[model samples]
Target: MEKVINAALCFDGNETQKTEWLDAIFSDVDRHYGYSNSFEKAIETTAGLMPQAFLNRVFQGTEEQQNRRSFFIRHGGIRRSPLSKIDVTDLIAWCQQRNTPEIWGLVASGIMLWEKADANENGYFLTTSAVTFLEAAPDPEPVLHAYADRVTPSGWTGSRADTMQPRADAIAELSLHVRQDISDAARSTSNRLAMEIERERIRDRQRDEDREQRFE
Candidate 1:
C-alpha cells in the first residue's frame, strides 16, 4: 500500500484535539508535527506528498482505534467540524475556487492548522480555536524577515514589498549545505561497509594461503 504523510498543528487549547483526530485517521508513525511555518503548511505538505490518496470526510477505519485515540482529548473539546469535513477533495475545491497556481500549490502541498481567535465586545481577549488539517502545500521557500534586518523594528505594516528573492537565495545556499552533509554521510557509510568487506576478503585469502603452505 502507498504511504501517506499526515502533518498536524493547533492552538495550545486544541493541541490535544488535533492529535486525537489525526491519530484516529492515520494511526501510525506516519504522523508528524511542526514541519512548516504554519498549520496550513503542515496540512498542505501532507496532501501534496500523496495526491492520489483518498481523503474521506470521516475515517472509516476502526471505531476501536477512534475511541482509543480520543483518550488524548479528554480535557479539550472534541475536534469536530460542522461542514463536510475538509479532505483532499475540499482542498482541491479550495484551489479551484482561487484559480491561481500559487494558491493551488499551497492548498495542494500546504499543511495548515489554525484556530479562530475569540472576540467579543469591549475587545476582550478570547479563546483561540484553530482548525488543523494535513492537506497538500506549496513548496518550501526561504524566510526573509524585514524586521530582522531593520535597525529599529516596530509593528508590521503587512504591505511592504517582500524581499523573498534574497531569502530564497539564502535558502538555496542552506539547501546546498544540507545536500553536502547528506552526501558526506552516505560516503562515510559506504566506506565503512567497503572496508569491512575488504577486511573479510583479506582474512579469507590469508587462511587459504596458510592451508596451501601446510599441504606443501
Candidate 2:
C-alpha cells in the first residue's frame, strides 16, 4: 500500500530524475531489505495515474533533508512501512536495527509527512504525486521525525477548498488550530490600539471638562 503510494508520488516528479531516484530506492529494498516481492514493480507499472507535483514536493524535501544528514541519497523520497497502518515508533526502531543509515531515516520521515499532510476532505485523497512519493519511500521513521520538526501543526493556514460547501467544515478544522493563533495575535493588537485610543480620548475629554469648569 505504501509502496504504491510512493510510486504514485514518483510519477509526479521530473521524469528523468524520478527514473534515477526510483532505481536507487528499489535497489536498496532488494539489497539490504531483501524485498523481491514485486511490490515496487507494481507501482512502476501503474505510473500513468500519478501526479507530478506531489512527487516533486516529495523529492524536493527528501533530497534536501537527506543532504542535511550527509547522505548522498539517490532516492527522491523516504521509505515506508510494509503495513498500511503500523506504529511509527516501532517502524523507526525496526529501521535502526536493520542498520539503516541517516538518509534512510529522512526518507521514512518524508513518507510519514505525506501521509499526514492535508488531503481532500471528501476522499482523504492525495494528489498522484503524493501517492507516487509514498510508493517510493524507503522507510517511515526518519520521515516522521522530520515532519514533527519541520511540518507539524503550526499557526493558521488555508487552501483553495476552504470556501466551498463540504470543504468549509474541513477548512475550519484545518484552519482552526493555526487560525486561533493568528486570532490571538490580532486580538492582542486590536486591544492595544483600542486602549491607546481610549486613553487619548479620555485625556482630551478631561481637559475639555476642566476648561469648562474653570470658565464657569
- After superposition, the stretches of candidate 2 with alpha carbons farther than 4 Å from their true spots are 1-41, 44-90, 98-108, 114-145, 148-216
Report residue 53 deviation for candidate 1 (angstroms).
Answer: 21
lDDT of each: 0.31, 0.37
Q: What is the TM-score of candidate 2?
A: 0.22
Find the candidate with the highest TM-score and give its number.
2
lDDT tens digits, residues 1-216, model 2? 656555555444567665665565444544443333344434433232332321222234354342432232223223432222323343344444446455444434333333223454332222233223323335333332332232213332342222122212222232222445433433443344345445645666787789899999
Worst lDDT 10-window in candidate 2: 159-168
Index of the highest-lDDT prediction: 2
RMSD for each model, in Å, please?
A: 23.0, 17.2
